[model samples]
Target: MSSETHEFKAEVAALLNLVTNSLYTNSEIFLRELISNAADALDKARFQALVDTSLDGQELESQILITVDKQAGTLTIEDTGIGMTREETAQNLGTIAHSGTLRYLEEMQRARAAGESSGAVEPNLIGQFGVGFYSAFMVADEVVVTTLSGKPGSEAVVWRSRGDGSYQVEPGSRSQRGTTIVLTLKTEAKEFLDRWRIEALVKRYSNYVMHPIRLRVIDEQGEDKDPEPRQINAASAIWARSSSELEDSDYTEFYKHVMGGFVMPGDEPFARLHFTADAPIQFHALLFVPGRAPADLFQEDRKALQLYARRVLVVENCDTLLPQYLRFVRGVVDSQDLPLNVSREMLQEHKSLAAIRRQLTRKTLKLLAELAEESADKYAKMWNEFGSVIKEGLHTDGGQRAELTELLRYRHVADTDDGLVSLKDYVAGMGEDQKYIWYVAGPNEAALRNSPHLEAVRAKGEDVLLMSDPVDEWVLQSLSEYEGKSFRSVTQGELDEPAEDEDIDDKDDDSDDKDDEAKAKDKREPSPIDPLLNLAKVVLGDRVRDVRASKRLTESPSCLVDAAGGLSRNMERILRMAQPGTKLGASPRILELNPDHPFVTAASKISETNKDDPRLAEWVEILHDIAALAEGTVPDPAGAAKRFTKVLNNLVAG
Candidate 1:
């Protein structure tokens, strides 16, 4: 029969340009696509043979054979499974049927322009778009495929492509069933003609492909020999194995193998979770929480788990398997049930995929909770290292907030120095009358523990959760309440509850009720210092949100707190510094003064004894600066220095 050349579909041309020109900088991944294709072909043949027993007892072993011809500068990957008839080869190779091609192309175009994620080929995208067959063009100048159908009397076919714009198909000479792809490596890509390079690429991308990947091994001798078959790929998927038959060391070794360079050498995994889901979706996962955080955990390229469709590695860094907060998790998600579009490159957005994600996240959080309970010291170390990342989910995922909240722990002044307490424990310890769960968030322990905002509550012997992580404030903002107790920032709002040892208990029966009188006295507003507050408010002007004598301040003269609905001072500072062009201006703060302090008493005297003393305005400004400094801010240090100089001069002159 006469051979004929056919033009590629327009979309196929675009897809070719993306792989060869933009994404295939390494070029070795072409082998992975070919091997994955071989695995797929074997799967089809195995299914057909099972249905029609007429094909039984043939050499039914499913394996992929690869050979390198150094002299010819070519690589051939041949599979022993279902081969295509001439008509089938022409039809499958000539057209693009995958619906996600346009979507994948749009994403790739954006990625290339942004210089993100464009460096590596996304295995699933290739499979989903059904363009993986054409990926060989990335490394080869010419590709030829020879195939014979596994069907009873179908003829062999040879498809040839220079991958410029056209391909040719004709009857082939192959006797047995299955397909063989031969690549005439480009001059620049001739490195793929080496046995070692082929082996390494197979191990990196397709080592776990279900079919044996047979490669001819070269020994130390310089002589060229006949092909002695050896399986290059493990051909066994780790997740497909039963948990009962596998040991921790087996899982550990598999994790290390899968993680490759992403995980640190010699570090252990914190935990491993293995399970299979039959309902909602059929999937098996071997998830591991790395013992040490990846050095690149904070980077945009943080590695994620591989996604496999039916043991054929489909997606690399399939982050949809877990949320960004759990990007540090390393493992495999193998599902025979995920409906991959033709070409197995792009997964259609199915309800089952979302359900799978929800299930995995729930199970992961449960595993962490179990670890925290069974091994507090170990989990604490993990929290100290990774809690910052976990807290991010609280701000981003509303549905998982409560689960994440329970999984979180924090160091507190209330707990022993290094120990942490959960919100549950703090709530359990709360007095029957306490209305909110109190917390103080800052940059570090020293800043938080030294904060004047915590003083009055500490004086009352009420505990406050000390949150030092920068993410803690944002997370608490998103997680407003847990189990009915609203989070109240000690640095933001007033505390109404009396001290734990205070006499509300004694007032149960009108027993002398000295505590009742004290409570009534404390309930009295800033009426005692109204004139002093008025004088300072006028002098400070818009510099302060409003001046008030604080019941929260006992040891310090003044402090700053957030407005009723506003973010905390520290949280604002963090936002302004971390984000550019934020227009955060200065956080509007209420300057609260300790009315009982000697300085305030002296300040009251100034308002009463010398209403026109210019020094009065100066001291009010000084108090504002001091509060700023105490709040860990450098608000006008030079101006504060000049003002302090004037204050010293006035004190001596007076």
Candidate 2:
């Protein structure tokens, strides 16, 4: 056969450079990549025949065949796919010329410059990149492609490249209407010639590939005679199987596969939600909550979700299936109704995709809730590992806030140190006099459990929810109330028990004459320390929105609470940490002092004894820092250190 030679396109050289220079992490992915390309080509051919009868019913079985010649160091991959015409062969092979290919290339080029050649390319641009095909050149010294267009009366074309700077195209003698690629393998790639090795690679990456991948075997006794072709992959979609037929081990193994061999931290999935949907979208997802979160689960960067359209892989790790709050979920979501050529932008706005996400989120929450009820131990492990991540949903995904709230668990003042209680449990235990759910957020469990804000609540025999997670404050923003009871911060505002009607009447008859004298005394002499509230307010005017007598504090001297409609101390701290150079611009927190506390009483005497002493103002500043420190914050490290030493010295001297 006579052939014509053509110089390689400029982009082809750059693409070859990218591939050989390391566009992929595993070299063996070249085989997987090439096989995937063949399968996609076959898919297009099969789909075309659905509308064009002339192209169907006569072509070879829609299957992929791979043959290896060890001595010649060549391997051939053939597929009865919609083969390319001459122009397409040059365009697709010689240069990147599909939709979004330029953008994909530009992105890859940027990633390549940052030494991230393995960075992601958009899923929908898999074929558009025209780069997966070049991956074959990673192991091959030369590549030859012979293709016959599926169109009737079309002539065959063969494309050849030597992994060098030139390629050739010529009229070829081929009766079949498909594509055949022959790779002259490099000596280092001879391992691929082993039948078992090929089988293993097929199972690892292409087991779920929709079409059959058959390998031609050569018998040891006679290399000339070929053995019957054997199917090397499962070629069946795993998630589409009925739940009854699947076992826990099956789901575990599949999770490992989809998640790139990530063994869930506890060597088990926290839970698995496997179900098929045919309503809004024809899709099924096999999602697992890892028994423990990965080290990078909280990071913004991660692999995409294993997004699939039909049985073909769209992206290995797609972020669109569920929101970032659910990033710890590891699994695959396959949609049968999504178009093969769906773009990344299209996917983000896709109605089917949105529907799938909604359903998956619901199933995930439902699964977690059921696990909490049925398997407390498993649910505890999950909460210990990923509860903070789940809590992020309370602030991010408003639609799921109610469901997410139901799954929230926390340490309660009433429960044992290791125990957790849900909101429902807290509500169930509430007394009739309790009209609000109370909680306090601090830096950690120990701090919250011992918090001064909790003292008053405990006195009334009411439990206060202990919240230490950073996301807890945000959760409280929109979740102010549940089941008709408002969520109130224990340290904020004021608390008063309901007045007893019987006690009021019983005391009324005895108090008339005595009340007159008691009221006269109260008007003449307030608590000795009450004057300090006014004094501290004058000294720390704008530093605090208000200085008030304590309603909750018992053992502690002072504590701060957010003003109405203001950010909590914990929330402001988190936001400040997340955004550097961004001021909190906070209005002063309300500082309340316990007038009965020994420290306040003693400080008041010192101020009363030396009315003009500046030490009173210094005491106020020191109190603020101490209160801030108790709340797990540093108001002024240097100033606090100086004031702490001065106060300690003064007390020791006295």
Candidate 3:
């Protein structure tokens, strides 16, 4: 045997050590890695043949043949694809140029900056890093790769590595224009030597690979009959099949296969969108919104969507398919138009891939809109699990914001009696003069229903949509208007209405006499004790922006409103979780007190007599506490508790 020794870079050695010993939890992924590398090689050969007509006539039977020798305790994968020269093998295997270890490190650094905790080293990340060939070290003690380049006069080469810091590449002899990988399995990895086990893995992970996968195995014909070798994988695009032929069970089965068979007992996909596109880029996609949100969906360092090329799964949980807002989506996007050996760096810059991304995003939004229209109940259930994500899309994707708004559902006063209605339905029942869509955001239905902000709208017989979801504030902030009508937050802005709607008719001659008598009686009535209300505002100036007699407050003693443009209490919590330790600018709040309420009336009388009384201070504190609770903010618990105890002690003493 001829051999030329080569030394690996320090980082390459470290990477190899990580892959061989620390990276992967499942060793079977090595087969998938090999298959993907072989596919890439075949793709390159096809691309080369297209450019050079001389290689067109070459009988390039692009397929993978896996041979398992139990007696020899070895597994070999052979591919009829573009091979490597001696120098190429030495550089590719010994150095980390082709592999994305450098890029992976960069990504880790970026992730860390974003405050994500990347706990364990990932071996399956090999595919993402583009050095999938090295994954063989996870299961094999030694890997021997024999290759023959497609170049007219290129010499064949053999590269051998033993999970160490160095490898050897030498001139080799091979009859075909391809590569073959022989894995000398470790004692613990002897199961890979079983034909059945190897065949199952090929079907499970690499079945969608465009190349036929043949397994050398013994098929029993009879009790005394010998076994025979055969092909195990279908090697076709499963998604290209017609939906008419695909049953729900079939789709579910495929999902389980792609998702690593982690299907929960009663869980079903909330929705599925399957379609094909050919214009900008040739692609087939099967997207599913899981019935339950994954435990990792909210995890700070959650993985992204899955990405595939030519039916061969490329990246698991690939975030590139859609924006992070659509992370709950699960599916495969098989694009034949994308380059097979493209690096992630290249993918980010590819024009055609970007176009495909735009198309897929639009298609997904359309599918969700269809679901909302087709079955309101089912769609509501989906919304309960993933509605926040859709709202997030509305907040971020301005181009599709209108469509997302149409798909939005909320509980209005009318619908609340039954619970939740779409904007379209609410718009359908709007009065002729109703030009603006009114919505109120609060902590819950009860709180929103009791909100003093709704009084003016209700007095005019108008229905205000109650937005209780935590995402509602952010959604409405971004979605300022819809269908040419402005969206008005009942709690924040000035109410504008036509003069006719606000005007009250003057009393007639006979009624004028009674009105004059009533006016004389009202003039004789005592003025409201405004001193106490002013005292309350002065005492709580630090906590509140303003205290005023509220025309909107009907049943409630007090209510709260943002003094300026900013996020509501609910939105503050959501933002805090997404960006930990991020300081947000504070917005002052208006405390609106109802003059007719007994608490306020009593405080008014108390302040008039005892302007300097400590009890008046206590009453003012209590009023602020009530308003803070209504606004869903935490009040000064100690001060409020002391005031409450004094009130109770006074009642007991009386």
Instruction: Report, for every candidate in turn, its global Cα lDDT versus the true structure.
Output: 0.76, 0.76, 0.71
Candidate 2: misplaced stretches above 4 Å? 1-63, 68-73, 79-180, 183-205, 210-234, 262-265, 342-349, 496-528, 538-543, 585-587, 602-626, 633-654
C-alpha lDDT of residue 303 in model 2 = 62
**Cα error, candidate 1, residue 293 (Å):** 2.6
Query: What digit string (tens of lDDT, one per residue) describes model 1 on residues 1-654?
Result: 777888877766776677566654446667777787677677666655655566632676788988877766778889887677777776677764442333434675797788864254333322444566777888888999999887787878899988777889887888888888998988998778677888888887787787788886333353444457777888887788888888877787787776674456656787889999999888999998888887789998778888877666667788788899988888889886687754445568999889889989999999999999999988888887789999999999988887888888977777757688888888898888677788888777877788898888888777888888888888876877777888888876445644233345435554443455455446656566677888988988787767777878888988887665466677876898789776977756788888888877887888887778877788888888878888678578999999989888977999
TM-score-best of 1 and 3: 1
Q: How many backbone clashes does candidate 3 have?
A: 4
Assess every candidate by TM-score: 0.78, 0.69, 0.68
The regions of model 1 sitting more than 4 angstroms off are: 1-29, 41-61, 82-179, 217-229, 261-266, 493-534, 603-607, 610-622, 639-654
Tell me, by lDDT, which candidate is best: 1
Clashes of each: 8, 4, 4
- Using TM-score as the measure, the top candidate is 1
What candidate 3 gets wrong by more than 4 Å, as runs, is 1-65, 70-73, 78-204, 210-226, 229-236, 300-303, 342-348, 432-435, 443-446, 493-529, 539-541, 564-588, 602-615, 632-634, 645-654
In candidate 2, what are the lDDT values of residues 389-417, reduced to their tens digit? 88988888898888898998988889865
lDDT of residue 235 for candidate 1: 80
> What residue pairs are clashing in model 2?
304-317, 304-318, 305-317, 305-318
